[model samples]
Target: MLIDWFTVAAQALNFLILVWLLKRFLYKPILNALDAREKRIAAELADADAKKAEARQERDEFQRKNEEIDQQRAALLTKSEEDATVERQRLLNEARKESDDLRTKWQEALRSEHQSLSEELTRRTREEVFAIARKTLADLATTNLEEQMTDAFIRRLHKLDSAERGELESAFKAASTPAIVRSTFDLPSAQRSAIEGVVKDVLAIETHVQFETAPDLVSGIELSANGHKVAWSIGNYLASLQKHVDDLLNVPPKAATKAIAPPEQQANG
Candidate 1:
């Protein structure tokens, strides 16, 4: 309760000085260290952020590369599938074409074989007919055949016109060499006499006529005139027939198939 101004003033002054000293030494140094530490932490944080951002960008770029690779793989697979489908279709078409060509060739071969068989059959039939005709003719070659042939030849001489008779006489007169006549049968005395009479009537000159038998003549009349032999026979007819066959075979027309009549189906009551 006593008034102490000097002590009070000194105490206040001492307190103010201690406060200033503590502020200068402790507060200022601590504040300065804290500020520097905060600045360093901020710089480190910024650096870390930049590194994270770079890592994120790298990850995005890797993901984008993977997506592009996947797309390219899908495109390649699709293209390969298309190419395989095209190849398969092309092979199928080629096989079908080959089958068609083979079928056509087979049909042509069958047609040719059938035609050849038919022609061979026709040729054999003709040959058989000619053989039978020749066989029958061989059986008819009797002793009386010579007499009949001579009578027939003499009959032809009588039917000759005046112009033919004069030509015969001229031919006989012009012939200095004797001509041998071919025959297929034996000559009889009556036939020879008949032939002599006809020859004398046609030529009006006496001449010696000889006869020969040759089986190769093929049933016909043959005469030699002025070193030229003229013949009319079944063999000549056959030769003409063979010529006609050759002409028919040279240009063959399209084969026409004959229609086969269908069997009638019985009506059910």
Candidate 2:
């Protein structure tokens, strides 16, 4: 019931003073520290998040670069393979062309060699044949060869028919112009008479049969009349043989022609 104003006043003042001390020392200081801690934590978390994002970006960039490098390597390998294949084909083609050229050259060489061999063989054969023939003919030209040939020719002339006899008479008459019979040697009396009788009998015409000795006719007879001359002589036969001897011997012209030719002819004067 009694009112104590001073005590009430003093208590009120004490309570206000306590409130000020709490606000200034305990409450204010605790609040300030908590705020500072929260700010520091937020800063630290933001820094960590930024670092993680940077790491992820770096990993993605590295992967992309690696993929690009792989693609470039694959392309280079493929190009190298194609180039190698092309080079191999080119080399093979070149080798084949060279081989073909070599084959053609070898064939040509073989053909030329064969032709040369054939020509040589032909020439040798011909030479051998002609040499054999010449030797055989020379052996047949014995001492009795002239008598045998003359007798045989006369006998063959006797075998002629009437029409052939008339032809022979005309031939002989036309062939005896100067009528001077020449001989290589003096004939026996009996032989001369026999020859005259045969000529008169066969031709049925006779004038005179004259004889002269001449050694140049090589032991054969010659008759000339009109524009014709008939000669049966060894020298003439030999000359005819010499003319074609090169072809018969099958030797080169220079060799065969020089070997058997007359001295004046061989000199080509």
Candidate 3:
């Protein structure tokens, strides 16, 4: 229990020295290592945060790009569909036009064939009628009819106007060949002499005369002087009748009506 100041001071000094040693060598070094580790960990954490932000930005950009691509694909698909629809319509229209054209051609062909058949039938009928009439007239022909026709021709010649008589006289004067009188049948001697006298008296010209038979005349008489001819024939009346019959049947008209020369007009002459 005795108070030892020397010992106390010495112990205090020793304790202080130990504390300084621990602080300088152990505490300071440990504190420096911990501070360095903490500084490195803080730098690492900051780097990780920056990387995470960059990754998030990249993810957002990728999503936006994906959305844009999807929209583009949809637009392309829509455009393709529209184009296909238009093409389909165009093809249908072309097909319809072709069908109409074919139908029109078919109808035209049918009409043409029908018209040709009608015309052929009409032609055959006309020919048969002409044949029958010719045969009938030939069967009905008589000597009395011939006499009457010869007399009628003589009267017709005498009835010629001044101008016609002058033309006949001039033709006879200029003609180098003899005049010919053609009939369906031979005229009697008396009828021939009567015709010769009438021709000479009416025309006031002297020309040689010849009589000839022409069955094609078909109940007709024809007189030819030079290139001029005068004729009267039942064939003209038959032609008129045939034309009227064709009209009644509603046949197509000919290019022209056949002309039958009048008594006062130039005929085959």
Candidate 4:
């Protein structure tokens, strides 16, 4: 424990020199190395942070793009569905119109055929009736029928009204050709003379008369002067009967009555 100041001072000086040498050589170089390492690590850390931010931005962009793609897909699907519906409706309308047109055409065809059949039936019936009437009349006594017809014709002339008498008188006076008297059979000389005498008396004129046989007269007698004619025929009666039949069959009227010429050529009287 004895105090020694000189030894203590010397040992203190050696300790200070050793400390300065270590600070200048070892500690300063080690500190500089540590600082360089820390700077490198900080730079690496900053780079990693920047990379992470870029990755986040890319992810966000990708997510937004995915959402936009989904919306576009949905819109396309909806449009496709609407278009399909419109097309289907158009096709259905076309089909319906075609069906209606076809049905109408078929109905028209059927109606036309029905009318044609009705007309044919009416024609056949008329021909058969005419044939039957001709046969029946032919089978009757020819001489008696002729005599009766002549008497009837003479009676008709006598029974003529004022208008009928006047028309015949005028026609006889104006006619350049002889009056024609037609019948289904030839008139006997006596009947012919009687008819001529009556015609002259009724017309009150001297008129030449010509006689002609017309088989189509069908048990009838006709007197024609100029364009005027008067007749009584079974054909007229048959024509009236045919009119009734045509009405019953719902047939349209035709120029089927040939028993008399037009009013300009014949008088009903």
Count the clashes in each prediction: 0, 0, 1, 0
Better candidate number, 1 or 4, judged by lDDT: 4
List pairs with backbone clashes in candidate 1: none
Of candidates 4 and 3, the better by TM-score: 4
Descending-TM-score candidate ranking: 4, 3, 2, 1
Better of 2 and 3 by lDDT: 3
Encode model 2's per-residue lDDT on 1-269: one tens digit a residue: 48799989998999999999999999999999999999999999998999889999999999999999999999999999999999999999999999988888888888888667755554454344335544565677633433433454346446667886666567667754434445555655654565566556766777466766675455455433344334454445444544465356677787766678899886885
TM-score of each: 0.39, 0.39, 0.43, 0.44
Candidate 3, 82-122: lDDT as tens digits: 99999999999999999999999999999899678756655
Write down the TM-score for model 1: 0.39
Error of 2 at 60 (Å): 1.8
Q: Which clashing pairs does model 2 show?
A: none
> Counting only residues 3 or more apart in sequence or on different chains, how many pairs clash (N, Cα, C under 3 Å) in candidate 2?
0
- Give RMSD (Å) of candidate 2 vs. truth: 19.3
Query: In model 4, which range of ten residues has the least summed lDDT?
Result: 251-260
List runs of model 1 lying over 4 Å from the truth.
1-25, 112-269
Candidate 2 residue 21 C-alpha distance from true site, Å? 5.2
Q: Write the per-residue lDDT of candidate 1 for residues 1-269, one digit (tens) a residue.
A: 68699989998999999999999999999999999999999999999999999999999999999999999999999999999999999999999999999999999999899789756655564456546655665677633444544555666667777887777667766788654556544556676666667676665778776666665455544445455443334455656766676666654453211122233422321
Rank candidates by lDDT, best first: 4, 3, 1, 2
